[model samples]
Target: MKHLRELTSLPTTGLYAAIGTFDGVHTGHQQLIQAMVNQAQKTSTECAVITFFPIPAIVIRNIQTPITLTSPEEKAALFEKLGLNYTITLQFTKEMAQLTPTEFIDLLVSNLPIKQIWVGEDFTFGHQRRGNTTVLSQLGMQYGFETIIVKHFLQNSEKISSSQIRNWLTSGDLESANKALGRPYSITGVVKHGDQRGSKIGFPTANLAVWEGKLLPASGVYATFAQVEGKIYTSVTNIGFRPTFVDNEPNAQVECYIHNFDRNIYDLPVQLFLVSRIRAEKRFESISALIQQIKNDAAKSEEILKHAEFQTGLLTGSTKTAP
Candidate 1:
């Protein structure tokens, strides 16, 4: 898919467009995107997604903590997999947030000949959150475009949403979060050098340097698939401070022990797709106790991975024990 960073760079040809913050690009967001793609294909018109970065909420609410489900790069990859023709990432700024509903629509309408605009029922936009599906249709008429509203994708009688998924992660509800996401929630980072404490303890782990603003699941041990150097490994990951080894850690540390594998992977990029939570992280009474717990976690992770469904194309690498 062709990705453009600015509205000015959009093509002049008429297109089917899906617009939203789409932070997680979760299953709810997928419905609207897929509908646009399907219609665009049937009509032989190009389709594009106009999404905002830093998400409007972080800018408008001045949220300081990391709350994103997927990074911009990851979201673009998902859109491409959904068969989008173009992906437009608009930088969210205070100035852009102040635009009136008409002004915002004008900017989009002028840049691209949008034939139809697809959005979820809960979608809204413009200054002070005044725009809604109703406003969109009114504006669509004036701009000579059709507004298509896709129903919410729901689970357990509740609409699936990014915020709800974040809540699930915070509460250590990996299964529900994964269900709404339509896949396991994942984090990508570069493996970095550490104190080799895991190595000393005989359970060597690759320390990951994750983005400061990336949202992480609750502190615990998890069953995960670690993608490294084009190979997938069944792994057990720990996402918390090593309370037994360190004092006063400023941030959570992510480290994973790739089962049945050993190699020098420092500085290499790794993506951890969390399948399920194994246990909560706690300080063991002794190093030996910690070693015993890790062994148990590894066995449990292997069993969980045996039947877990992996996202397609992500398993292009070896699904068995990575060398």
Candidate 2:
């Protein structure tokens, strides 16, 4: 797929496009994108996902905390995996937010030969989110294009959304979140050097430098698959401040001890897929106690991965792009 940063030079035309933030590209997003892809393929039209970076909510709502589930690069990779011909990352800015519905539609219409626009029933856009599916359809008519509204994808009567999945992750409900996402919830980051406390304890961990605004799962020990250098390793991951060793940490840290591995992977990118929550993070009484718990966590993670079927989505080696 051609992952373009701007619409200035689109590689192809006659586009069947879906426009959204598509934070995690969860199950709901997958279905909608797949539907568009299927129809685009049948009609022999190039398809694209027009998404915004720094997401609209962060800019409009002035959100101060980390809430993104996927980074722009990660989303582009996911879009490519979904068989899209193009993944356009629009650089969202405060000035762009001032555009009216007509202006926004005009911008897209001016850029490419958009044959059809696909969006969810409740999708909104334009200044102050005044534009809805109805407004989009009207604009489509004016611009000589078709608008398709996809129904909400529901699970137990609740619509699967990025916000809902965030709540699930914050609550440590990996099962529900993974079900909604159609894959294990993952965090991708570069490995950086940390305090070497884990090494002293005989559990050397790869400290991850995750994106600033990305939301992390609840503070806990989790069974995870760590993808590094194109290999998947069973791992025990911790996402929380080490209260036992330090106090008042400024941010949550992700540290994972890969099982049966010993290599200097610092500065390399690693993706951790949380399989299940083993236990909540806690302050141990002593260093020995913490070491013991780490051993237990590793054993449990190994057992969990042993019985679980191999998962495929979003892993580095498993990803494929449209031809």
Candidate 3:
């Protein structure tokens, strides 16, 4: 998909546009995007997604939220997967934030033949967040464009939202969160050099230092899957400071020990999909103690993988251990 960084540089074409931070691109966001696609197809217009860079939460909070479910690059990839024609990532600025509702719309819609706008039911925009669905619908009539608002998606009578998904992730409920997201939540990062303590203990792991502003799940040992070079492997990941080893370290870290896999993958990018939490991070008093704990962790991970394999109906012709 074409990424237009500046709204002013957007070409003049009648486009059906969906707007949101689309952080997780959860089920609710998908509904809106699908609606936009259908509307664009019916109207014979280009389908486009208008999202923001440096999401408002990151800019406003000034705290790096853990490992994101998807990075900006991943979000773009998803847009392509969803069959969008163009993706616009607006560089949000303080000046843009100050624009009145009408001014914001005028600036965004200017020089572009926008035939329709799609947003979620609770969508809001403009200065001090004054723009709401009511204002958007009113402006659509005034501007001679159509507006579509998708109702919030409900699961078990509760609204499925990014925040709720975040809550699920924080609570280590990956299955439920994945169900709400319509896909697995993943964290992408490059392998980094660690203390090599795991290797010394016969469980070599690839340390993954997450990107800035990425939202990470709670600190725990989790059954996970890792994707590397387009291949998926079941693994166990530890998401926390190595409390058993480095009790004084302040920052938490993500380290994954891929089961039945051994390859020189240092610096290679990998995506980790959490499947389930096995246990909370804890401090072990001795190296032997930690090693024993890791063995047990690996055993639990193997059991979880076997069950997952059965559930997914993955055929394993042979147990070829990775080297």
Candidate 4:
């Protein structure tokens, strides 16, 4: 997908666009995006997407601890997979937020030959949030374009939303979050250095620097896998500061011990797909007790990950006991 970093004056021809943050691109979002692509195809125009970064909430409310469902890079990869022709990530600024509904629509119509526009039922924009489907259609007619509003996609009688997904993840309901997302939620980043504490415990780990602003699941041990060079390996990951060692820290850490594998993987890229939460992290009485519990955690991880793999058909790495 052509990533348009320049927000202003986008050179375009025959573009049909969808506009939203599309953070997780849940099932509802997938339907909206696919409809946009289909409309673009019917009109013989390019399928494009536009979103604002730093999130409207963070920019407007100044949320102290802002968490994102998808990192910018992750969102790009997903949109590309969904067969979009281009994605324009505009930096959210105070000035842009001040545009009136008509002004924003005029901006889009002027910049690109927008043949059609797609959005979800709850989608709205412009100053004081005055934009809606009705206003959008009126503007579309004035600009000689079409507007499409997709129905809210639902699962189990409830609307699937990114906020709902975040609640599920925060509550450690990986299955529910995955159900709404139509795929396992994952985090991708480069492996970074950590205190060599895991080495002394005989269960070395790959410390990962998670994507900034990406929301992490609840603080616990998780049954997961690591993807490196297209090969998958069974992994047990911890997603909290070592409560057994550290106390009252502001930052949380993510690190995973790859079972049955030994290699220097620091500084390499890896994607960790969290399959299931194993247990909440706890402080042990002694180092010996902690070591023993880790061994049990490894066994439990393999079992849970194998079951999840069979159910989801993803990351079926070695499930047997690691030598």
Put down candidate 4 lDDT per residue, 1-323, tens digits, no spaces: 78876545545567778999888878888889988887677867788888878778778777767479886667777788778998888888888889999999888777777888898988898987899889999998999988888999999999999999999998889889988888778877788988999998899999998776889888899888777766677899999878887888578889899998888988899888787888988888799999999999999998877766522222233344323
lDDT of 3 by residue, 102-143 (tens): 997887677567888899999999888999999998998888
Predicted structure 2, TM vs. truth: 0.96
Backbone Cα, N, C clashes tallied per candidate = 0, 0, 9, 0
- Candidate 4 clash pair list: none
Q: Where is model 3 more than 4 Å wrong at Cα?
A: 8-12, 61-68, 309-323
Q: Write the per-residue lDDT of candidate 2 for residues 135-240, one digit (tens) a residue.
A: 9999998999999999999999999999999999999999999989888888988999999998988999999999888899999999988888877788899999
Candidate 3 residue 7 C-alpha distance from true site, Å: 1.9
Q: Residue pairs in steric clash, candidate 3?
A: 65-214, 66-214, 66-215, 66-216, 67-214, 67-215, 67-216, 68-214, 68-215
Model 2 spans with C-alpha error above 4 angstroms: 9-13, 312-323
State residue 121's C-alpha deviation in candidate 1, in Å: 1.0
> Which model is ahead, 1 or 3, in terms of TM-score?
1
TM-score of each: 0.96, 0.96, 0.90, 0.92
Arranged by TM-score with the best first, the candidates are: 1, 2, 4, 3
**Model 3 global lDDT (CA atoms, 0 to 1):** 0.79
Model 4 off-target regions past 4 Å? 8-12, 310-323
Q: Model 1 over residues 2-109: C-alpha lDDT tens digits?
A: 888888645547889999988788888887898888888898999999998988999999999999988788888989989999999999999999999999999998
State each model's CA lDDT, in order: 0.88, 0.89, 0.79, 0.82
